[model samples]
Target chain A: MIVRPRLEDHLVIGKYTGKVIVGVGLLMVIPLLVSLGFGEWDTAVDFVISISACLIFGFGTQLFCRTEKDMNWSHGLVVASGAWVWATALGALPHYLSGHASSYLDTLFDVMSGYTTTGLYLLQDIDHIANGLNMWRHLLTYAGGQGIVVIALTFLFKGTSGAYKVYVGEGKDEKLLPNVVHTARAIWLVSLTWLVVGTAALTATGIWLGQMPIRAFFHAMWVFMGAWSTGGFAPQSYNTFWFHSLTYETICIVIMIAGSFNFALHWAMWTGNLKEIRRNVETISMFVTLSVTTLAATFWLAKANVYPDAMSLLRKVFYQIVSGHTTTGFSTVYAKAFVTQWGPIGLVVTTIAMAIGASACSTGGGIKGIRMGIMSKAFLQDIRRMVSPESALVSQKYHHIRDVWLDDGLVRGAMTITVAYVTIYAVATIVGVLYGFPLDQAAFEAVSAASNTGLSCGVTAPTIPALMKVTYIASMWLGRLEFMSVFALGGYLWSVVRGR
Target chain B: MMTRTRTLTVLVVSGAMLAALAAPAFALATYPPNKPDSTELINHQNVLGDVTKGLFWNGKAITFHGEAIGEVMVRGDYAWIHLNDDAYMVENIEEGAKLGGYNSGMAVWVPSALTKQIDTYGDYQHEGSIVSIAGVFNGACKQHGGDMDIHATSLRVLAAGHVVVDPVRPWKVVLAVVLASIAGLLFWFERKYRYLLRQSGRVGT
Candidate 1:
């Protein structure tokens, strides 16, 4: 049956879309107040201007586009993309006013990085920034990781149609619970609980390791949210290197893993069904990937004399491997130091982990592990068919929780998209190289930026060529939306403007 | 056997020397002594003697010929001037050659009373040109970190000239343009096949 698209669907989605934007504007007020509380007058002023601007636009959209309708696919795409752009523009206010960033463009880069949970920063001296403002930066990561739309949909919207559109538009394909609202709430609750417990544990470790009490507490809180959300903005200027203890690294490891787990699994555990833990395809794949990568990296680091002993080797390997695979972007070992010592192979493996990214339905960014699992299953089936006798007929089926037959169309589609992603990734790297970055460093930075991983080989700086900065920005944008939404938004714009 | 041992020792020593020479280059480069550390550096009130090692205010580089008290102010360029006795503004005397201290190009505001002694002893202009200042050796004054200005009792300006303002270099412009072009290209591609891209997911089913 052909389902004709309706204007009412678009209008309904547009109304909620406006509300979501307005909600984001309201959220901006919290950070604005925080900046003011710290006596960062300039930052406070900038936030005021930004909040006012956002409120004007957001509320104006709602007021003008009031309708009693539901959202369509096109409406969902527009709302999602428009919200991100608006958030990025408004979020740059604090960075711009803080005076750490050199230019408005640089501030946008940093803000995009934070909101996208990429963890790349243009701010030079984070240590000196006011406490309240610093907290706001990490808060953006936390909010962005779960998605502002998801939060708004769960808390504000009651209608099933609106919630479903927003849910899918926010890139959450799987519903852990029967009700979309319940699933969203459960995800947030589980994440929040982990955040609190993780913060307390890390804070204790920080104090024990001799960090100043207040600073330690704040650092722990920010790092915990960032890691558990896989957001990656560290409170200190040194990033994760400030807490140079194995205990600190281990805590982060757990947080990253927790952040990268599919929320459906968390909800299942919440319902006292522990068997869901064993059955998750994404989780199992992630675990296997983590183990293999960590061991390999550890061996490589030891061989290169980057780590002196087995314990030190494990610490570096495990921390970095987890950071990359989870797309958390926190680093115990400085990338600049590691790149110089470990050479090409080290960079390549880490890049692969970042590109593979974390489990779907989690906060982490990238192509996601579930998609990779599907691709891998299809690849194996193809191999099986090739090995079978010419005259023999075979039907291949794969089992996860249930048996599913593999088809050529499924395999072809996945491969096509994967290739498209790779092409985008390669172009970004090539741009970096064209701008005079060494080949390895260029590739590493490109992958990190595109995956929204924020792991750096010391190439990302304010001084980096403007062309390269723009490339990184595109990568971050595409990565956060998983590329598809961005494309849809582009098409929508073209259709409107060009009558195509 | 003795010659062989001597050669091995020489080879080892040379290898160690080569490694040592290469190590600093491989490590992340620190800013030169005068360049400000973005994190720890701040501008605060300090005595002239204390300001010798740290960042210099504006154009004024101070050397302690003798103890002086006055308010110090950093001007537009790398010139720092202190006013001596009398807690008021005055014209500053040009001192010697080098501008001493960190050159992060940030201005510090301080009281004129600090430069009273120098105002009385040296050439002082009362047109609010020179002020007394005292501050610690904070490396750089960024917006995030609080201001860095040294307290002074004397007024003196080493020299004055057209302080060169550095523009955003050409390389940065080139880099930015290149990046923007790539973004434009991506935007174009995304617009082109958006339907195919979006429907590809459902197409498998």
Candidate 2:
């Protein structure tokens, strides 16, 4: 039996969601101040309008729908989902106003891409953009990578359990402290510490590469934000090619690998538990997958003789495979080169890596490592059952923060989300084929989009069909949220349309 | 008398016609630059092969006005420089505010001697040198991993670029002032709430 949610339930959600939105508005002040400092008055005005709109809409919603009712799990999920939708819509104002994006839809696509940490962009004239707008671009990825809701938990929301609910609903399960807010702070603390170190190192390298100190610092900070978030946005149209330094590439590679590590792993490392780095289930899984994918891509490229030498092959082909695997989407090769240079085998290896993705509770999206671990366990268990005695009993255990014994419920959850991800990837591929894109390119791009990996095989441009654009957008949203909140939103909408 | 007058008129007319034909030739002799003796003239689109393959211009010396984009990537004796001759351009930094659409560019490897004249590189803040290059374009170069590139035989900066000055809009000041005031109001309200809470002993001061 289904109990239709009353209108009052929505009011409760609106109140909390409005709180998150207000937090987002306040967060805009950093960029606003940056633009003002840089005297990028055009970008400043756009931020002013956007910031004002967020505050007004947020306060108004809270004023009208203010509720004393305690937030349930459903209410928390609704608020989290609502916050993302609102964030994407209102967050798009800066991109749209900047005149870089073609339209409101394009801005929305880019905003969602940033917030989801999917590095795909519909932004044009990136090289000529103001410092302030560029700051906002990288900032969105950084903030979104940790999560806006998590920020709200630290300062805005007062309730403890309700805050935890919202956190869980945002597709995060790891908690470093008994208090969720403390955990949020710990995550930020780790990230900020890395940020300072990474930025300083990168800035030095940038200066060495002949950039002015100020420009070097700016590039360092933005690139750090992109890398730390695994967001993959570069300040120039050529992306990483602008710097053209091997040192810069190496630093970014380190950052990308580190960024894809789970916050739990970071917490363990912060303590005396150094073994956590090796023994973690996600680490082992990453090792296996990375080796397979990297080797497969290298051997294929070597056979094809696509690149001239070992250096070129590693720089162009290996880096891309690593980028796809980490879901970092930092491409040294041109977008079209996926089709032209890498060829079929290279694309397949990249597609597999993209689908496998990075560690769970990290700044990456796809079928996470923990789930893959569980799935592998389940496969082994089934095979053991088939071969052994009828009464044979085998138990599986995986080390995360602790030993997590595999259960039916865990398997079900893992399998369900994995199936959902695969289904969406397949659907997007079919739609791409229907639109006349070649088969392998479609599959590669589909997996890229659905997995929130920003690597493109040249299909995700402004010129693509409108339906395809929306399809990719939906795939990113669903994949990022891991399908639960979106399903809830869909169910709620359906109930409203049909129910008494 | 009529025969002599007719002969004088014909001589005068022929002299004027000869002078008129020789005028452009004299101007060409005094002109500052030697015309680059190249048959093919190309743009960024021709080098990048956007709508169609740029195979015809491949391995051919051509001349075009190209704006050096990004940094002059200094690699040993030679430099890898990117240049654009696209329709998308700003006459000045202020004019760049109204720019719409994407930036298109092509990479050219030129001797450092030629690139020394490039004082400014095109980016958000500064415009690069718009130089005309007589170079050979490789559609698929064995060097640089099949990248489409140009090897320049000669390069000349036709126009110089300056730092773009982005002016502050008046409305921005107004909004900033307004938002600051609102922020101030909120701060006061928060202080008042804390004062009341202190009076009520709900929290430690």
Candidate 3:
């Protein structure tokens, strides 16, 4: 029998939701200070305005819808979904007010992409943009990658029964520590440490590669932070292509691999479990996939006559393959030239890599290797079952920490999400093609944007039609939330609107 | 064991064949001077084909043939030209010296010697008129970093005409429409049959 969840239940959800919004408001102040420190008065003003708006709305919601207890699963889902949309709205204000983006829609798209770590952009001259604004872009990616809610839950919420629900809703599972706050802090610390190491190495490389020392330092810091976080924003207009040196590419590759690793593995490493490196399925899969795709792409580029020599071809191929697989979206080659020259095969291979995505519980986005591993195991089990008789109850198993048997419910849930992911990609691709893009290019952009992979076929330009931009924005939002929470939120909203 | 080995051999061979067939059209490093930095103009005056290959212009690295060769005026090291072979009027030439060239063509820098020859032989005309100039190939130009240009050795008159070409193709439009329609349908289907879509996974037995 169906039962209506009470208003009290919603109020319980609202109280945590209100706290999260307030936390988001507080977080905005850091970027605000960054903007002020950089003397970007306009950006600082915009941040102040946005923060004020967020605080007012958040506090108002808390006051009107007060509750005394923790939230339920349904409430948690609503709050999780609500936070993403609200955060995106607030995030757009700085872009809009600073005049970085021409329209509100473009601003929203940029913000959504930033927070989601999708790396897509509408701004034409990123090189000319101020340091504070650029930092804010990566900051969003770092925040969004770990999830703003996770930050809030860790710092603000104690004795909150909805923590696990919120965690799952934020598209993560498996905590590194017993306390949720400790787990959150550990993830942030590991990420920040990598960010520091990555930034320094990349900066030194940039200076050695002949960029002006000051520019090199800034580029190295921003690019490393973005790349390691899988944020994909480059401080310069040329993205990674501008540096045009092997050293720059190598540093980016290292950072991308680091970003694609699950934080839990990092935690295990920190705790002195050296064996965790070999045991982690996500890391192993990422390495294997990176190797195979890099070699394949290198071979393909050489065969296609795209480059004159094997070494040059390999360089281009490796850079792109790594970029797409990690969903970093920073291209060494011009997208227009790549699309025009390599044809459908190159596009297909890159898109497939993007769709396959990166390691779970990392900044990178897509279907994720963990899900892919789960799907692969399920497929093998089905094949085995078909060959065996009714008496044969062969145990279906896959290794995570250890050999773990999968039950029907778990497998079904994993499959459902995977299928939903593919469907989203397929739909987005069709929309892209319909708006005057080639079939291959359309599919590539759709999957790239939808998976928040950020790779482009030269179609994602400032001049792109508004409808197509809207399509990409929707795809980025849906991809980041992994579809389920968004769907759940929609169901909840519909129920409320219907007065059920 | 023998059968397994045979199967593996066949698979390997097949993979090799596929790789070979799908090989990139251009050979890496085969394109002579694989790095752009190593690109130098080899004197093969009568050579004709794709302009990119024939007579290389250092500043832009683009090669062109046909009627009027474009004129790009220069003073000191700086040169100004309307980008992408666009038409330039004398009044619209900004503050640079005038050189004779075709209307609606890329502007390029010429050596001082060639500029003097044009100044002596030709009458002062609007920058927009189409004209051809002969010149020795300069390896690279200083005005724009990382570009190539030619030093005009002489001037010549080719036919006066404008090059026109359509920008869009029918196939591109058709393909785009089809893809969009498919995307719309999928979105609707997913929305309508969300539960059904959810069940269709490779994982979850």
Candidate 4:
């Protein structure tokens, strides 16, 4: 029997959701200060309005839904999914207020795209946008890269079992420490350390490339946020190509790959388990897949004589493949170059790299390396079972942090999510084709959105159909959260609608 | 009087013939950019597309026009300037320009002497100088680590960029103040409830 959610359930969910909104509101302060610092009075006013709106919504919910009850698993999942929806709607205020977006829906699309770490944007004239608004854009991706729930847990929420549930609900299940709050802090520690080092390196590179000192610092910081978060929101429309520096590109590649590693892996490396990088299954899977895709793209482009020299071929192909595989969405070449320059084969290669994405429990969104690792082991196990005698027992094990035996449930979980991803990719592709996009371009864009890899092959634009925008938005949300929590949210809503 | 009249007619007719003959040459020199017919001029899309189909434009003379944006990075004798040809190149978002997709532009490597003609570069405040470049397009420049760029032989400023004044909407400020006041009251109310809950041991510190 489908029992409707009781009053207490709603209260707990609402209270936690309110807290996340408050955290989001607090986030607006950083951009507000930035706007003021730049003397952008109009943009600062946008942040002021947005901040006030968030506070009102947050406090209103908290005051109305005062609950002593703790959150259950369902409440946690609902809070996670519901919070993102609310965040997307409200966080879009600065974007809409900027008068750059075509409509509120377009602003929502950009906000969702940022939160999901998918680099597709509909905000027009990014080149001419105010510095303060630009700060908010990059900051959205950075905060969203570290699960928003993690932020609430780090600062707002107490160290309770409910915190862990909410943490898992945010699509990050790995616990770097025994306490969930401590785990969240550890993630921040890793990110902040990278932020310092990556920014300095990029700033130096930017300055060397002839950018002004202040401009270099800002660009460096924004690019670092985008790179380390594996979020592809560059300040300019040209993206990484704006610099036209090999040194800068190299630095981005390093940060992007490092960012895509599992948080637990970072914890291990920090704790002097350097050998774990070699032994980890996710790392191994990433290496093999990245190599295959890179080689395929390089060889194909070389054959087509796309680039003039070997140096040109390697720089463009390797940078793009790494960007795609990391799900970073940062690109050196123009978006259409994938279609017009590299052709169908290049598109297929990049799509494959994007589909098989970065490590599990990382900021990146895709099928994930760990799942691929497990599935490959399962395949091997099945092959061994076929060769063995009727009485023989076949089993397989893969090393993540440690060696763990692959069981039916584990395989089923991986397969289910993989199937879900493939299904969404197909649906998105069909919608795009129906809108008159070519099959290959549609497939490429659909996969890009579904994988939360923001690489565009000249498909994503402000002029795309509104329905396609909605479709991509849903794909990004679904892709970011994986499927289970969102599915739970759907089931919860359905029960509310038709429950006895 | 007859002789003077005849001389005047001959000069007028000759001048008219000469002017007519020079018009086509002048028009060819100032051809419109981005309207390539597989012959003379090419845009960003064409440059990229032609290269992909094994049509290399390396060291080929091409004419391009766009609004000069960002800073001019002067590296010794040569300077790098990015020029955008997007819809907003003429007008901007603050000026009520309609959305026309993402910015599409190319990097031009021009002499430091030529870059002095640009008065403004596009950004939030200004609409940048619109310039035309007659250059040799390089598919991959060996000097700049495989960067696709144009080496400009000559440059001309077609239009001057100007400051765009963006006024703050009064209604937004009024709404912000009202919302902030309400939020403050809610915060106080929520804090009061939290204190009560804490006192009753229903919530933790």
Candidate 5:
């Protein structure tokens, strides 16, 4: 006649949650150092306060609750889900203190957006924000792209059983190494290597294109972080258009494409298993979806006479498509141009690309290529079965680490998540529309938020309704965690509240 | 005779008042002529928007004033400049003292000689110069891959910008110190918790 939480439940959650909180605090240290180095006393103080708050809260949970239980699946899910909300709240500290955001809600929105790599910004006066605060914004996305849970796992999470559970909960399914720690290490290694290589490339480009050396280096790093993470932040509000260089755009395009690749494929290709690139299911899926959507948009733009020459068309139109498809949200064209210049057809195609999004186990978001691939294969298999004789044995197979069979459970799971993502996008769209935005523009921004793709047709701004802002924050959060974990969190909370 | 004298005095006063108004207009006319039609200013949004029969704005040689933001992007003999018409500038002129939000701005193409005259640009530490640009607006410029830009013939600094000083507030420092102290207390408790665990020889997830 009574409901109860096991002692171990409280302990395991607290322990790992504490470690994650510590990791969150640790992230602030970078910004703090930046502020100090730049002589931004106010910003430095913000980080100091932020770091202290995170540490106290994190360790407070650990002190109050202690346990020896290793994390079960449920605990991992809870920790992963709960930690995000906590990290986001704490992460908002520096931003809120910097006086850029109009409200705590606004700052929280920015942090959530950054952590989800959603690219929607609520922070006001972005161009005037301190270096440390700006670094924090880009840093959160860079870390978020790679999954902040992975940082906790790599550095703080000591026990393997619990560590692996939390890692999977953060939406990383692949065990890149035999050990969970090793897997986290490998992910960091890949990210850090890309950071170095990509930053160096962009920085050199920045310098050659005529910027001061220090400015060039930092801008390169920030831009590289955004591109490689498929995050849509820029140093200036003008975004990628600020540079106005073909060379810069070309390099960024390359980084976005490379960033959207499956990390396993990266590992395989790096380690001389070059054939893996052709065999990866996510890659094939991306190729088909990207090509189809891209062609459709390009055709519409050309017919409308949006661009005169093929070069300009390729540069402008093709750039938007890739950015959308990758869910990177870096656009060469103006935001309203999507509505006015490209018209209805272009908007539809772009929304499709945004919803489809980038590859799984990579620094991108949305109804990942793997799910789309599975759904497509499942559809084809059903058609083939319907056409063929009933007696004939029929099976579908796809290569993703190896030959993965299209089992009913696998198909159903993929379809369910895909459907959930679509529904969330739709609901957010409805919210946007109800708040007085045009349907197409509302839908565009909604898909952008829910899919973590940050292209806007003018709905996302400071003047947008509070309801709309909250809706977007939820969309980004739900989209990043991919629904199931969030659903799990909701269930867990409901049980805690109403069970007894 | 008295009525006629009174009428003459009234006419004289009215004529003087008219002359006084004309003097300001004459002074305004002395400044370099820019606007093709009327002496009206336009914001970036209006220049890029405000379409009429597919044309954004129906004029050439417009005069506009906006805060110069970021660096003057130099390329060959020409330079690309951005002028911000954000809430800050609006509120600064019309309402508040502080500027907030991402500004609405337009790209301006000017001669290299013109850009060098700017002493300050908008950023975290400094407010940018307010400058008046006499330019032709193009909604879709063919010269720069269909950019909505202004090709400027002349620029004049209307106002110089100064550096902004932002020091850490004492209250913020105090709050930080208090929070750090709480963290210290938590650290002590954590150490005790760890010691108790070590004594028990139990490893937690």
Candidate 6:
């Protein structure tokens, strides 16, 4: 029997969603201070207006939807998904007010992309945008990478038990500690520690590469944010290519690989479980997939004579493959070069890498390495069972934070999510093809969006069919939330319309 | 003899006119000139579009023009400067220019001495110097770890850049003030609502 949500259910969802909105408003203060620091009065006004709007909506919702009821599972799922929609809508104010995006929809797309850590953008004249706006863009990725729900859990939510449900709804199921709030803080500690070290290294490299000290510092901070989040939002249009330095690319590579690691793995390493790095299934899976993709891409490029020599081949092929595998969209080449230079084989190899993506419970998005590891072991166990006696027992074991034997439910769950990812990727690709893009290019872009890898092959632009833009937006949202939460949100809305 | 002379002279003149008429068509059929016409110069999108359609401009000398954006980063005898040819090059967003599209630009590697002619670079505060350069475009420069760049042989500043004064709009200021006041009132109400909930030991749906 279908049961409609009660008034308290609505209140609980609204109250929690308001708290998230408040957090979004608080986040604007960083950029607001930045604009004031640079004496960008016009830009400062944009933030002020945006901040004010956020506060009004957030506070008004809280005041009106006051309730003592704690969030249940459905409320948590709805809040997690619903908060993203609100955040994206409100968060776009700064981008729109800057007069950069072509329209309000474009701004929403950019904000959603930023929050999902998908780096595709449609902001016009990014080079001419204010420093504060640039700060906000990169900051969006950094905060988004930590998961907005995680941020809310860390500070706003006083109730502990229900908080974990919301945290799980954000697609981060692994807890580094027993308490969800502690887990959120631990994620922050890992990110902040990397921020300092990574920013300093990149700053030095930028200065050595002849950028002015101030410019180097700001670029370093922005790039560090982009790389650490695997969000790939470089301050300039040229992306990492603007620097044109090997050292900068190397630093980005290191940060990107590290950032793609699971938070639990980081905790293990931080707490003296050094051997965990070697025996971890996710790491092993990542290494194998990266090696295969890199080899395939390198071979393809070598045959095409894309680069003149070995070093160029290594730099171009290896870097791009790693960027794709980590699901970071930072590119050293122009967008069209993939179509012009890399050819179809190179494109397919990269698409595969992006589809496999990085570790589970990390900033990255895709099928996830942990799932791949389990599925591979499952396949191996199945093959062994086929050859053995019919009554004999066959089990597959994988090491994550600890050794675990894969069960039928675990494999089924992994397969379901993987199927969901593949389905979305195909749907998005078909939409792109309907818009008259080449099949290979469409597939590449669709997978890129669906996997939250922001690499583009000249298809993503302001002038693309608005329908295609919406499709990519939906893909990014679904892929980031891993489908389940969004499904729950859909069911809740349907029930509201037709429940008995 | 006089008639023959007249006929030959007329024929010679006719032949000369016909030759002149055919020359332009012949020239059009021949290979295009190395120097690009100012009106027909390729923009970023054109170059990118061509590449996306499977055309390579590697090792090809081309002409590109745009506003010199950001700062010139010097490395040895050559410096790297990004040139933006987007709509905001002449007027900016703050100056009430309609949004065109995303910034489309190319990276140029010019001699350090040539960059001196560029006085200003575009940012939030100023419009950058507009410069045109003739260069060899690399699809992937082997020297710079396969980066897409242009190695320029010549540069000319077409327009001098000046500071753009972007005074805050009065309407925005007024709107901001109004919104901030409303937000403050709402915050107070929110706190009061929470307080009432606590005091009553139950909350309204």
What would the TM-scores of all predictions be? 0.69, 0.85, 0.71, 0.92, 0.90, 0.91
Off by over 4 Å in 1: A1-14, A36-42, A389-405, A408-410, B1-205
Worst 10 residues of 2 chain A by lDDT: A59-68
When 3 and 4 are scored with lDDT, the better candidate is 4
* Higher-scoring candidate on lDDT, 2 or 4: 4
TM-score of chain A of each: 0.92, 0.97, 0.94, 0.99, 0.98, 0.99
Candidates 4 and 5 compared by TM-score, better number: 4
lDDT tens per residue, model 6, A1-500? 66788888888888889989989999999999999998999999999999999999888888888777778888888999999999999999999988888889899989989998889999988888899999999999999888988888888887558898888889899989888889998999999999999999999998888888988999999999888888889998888989988889999999999989998999999989999999999999999999999999998888777776899889988888988999988999777778767878888999999999988889998899999998999999999999999999988899998999899999999999999999999999999999999999999999999888899888899999889999999999999999888998998998888887
lDDT of each: 0.62, 0.77, 0.64, 0.87, 0.81, 0.87
Residue A181 local lDDT, model 6 = 87
- Sliding window of 10 residues with minimal summed lDDT for model 5 chain A: A1-10
lDDT of 2: 0.77
Better of 4 and 6 by TM-score: 4
> What is the per-residue lDDT of model 5 for residues A1-500, given as tens digits with 9 covering 90 to 100?
33545677877788788889999999899989988888889899999999999999889988877776678887888899899999999999998888777788988889998998878887777767788988999999999988999999888876567788888888788887779888888888988998999999888888777676887888899998888888888888778887778889999999998888878878778678889888889999999988998789878777766554667766787788889989888877667667766777888899999999998888888999999989999999999999999998789999987899999999999988899999999999999888888888899999999989888876798778888889999999898888767777787777777766
lDDT of 3 by residue, B61-140 (tens): 33332122223334444332211221122211221212212222222444444333232111111222223444434332
Residue runs of model 6 more than 4 Å from their true location after superposition: B1-56, B197-205
**B40-124, model 2: which lDDT tens digit per residue?**
2222122121424344455767655556776775667787777765433334234443344445556677888888988878766
* Cα displacement (Å) at residue A63, model 2: 2.2
DockQ of each: 0.02, 0.16, 0.02, 0.32, 0.27, 0.31
Residue B91 C-alpha lDDT in model 4: 77
True lDDT of residue A236, candidate 4: 88
| Worst-scoring 10-residue span by lDDT in model 2 chain B | B36-45
Error of 6 at A470 (Å): 1.0
Q: How many residue pairs clash in each candidate?
A: 72, 0, 36, 0, 0, 0
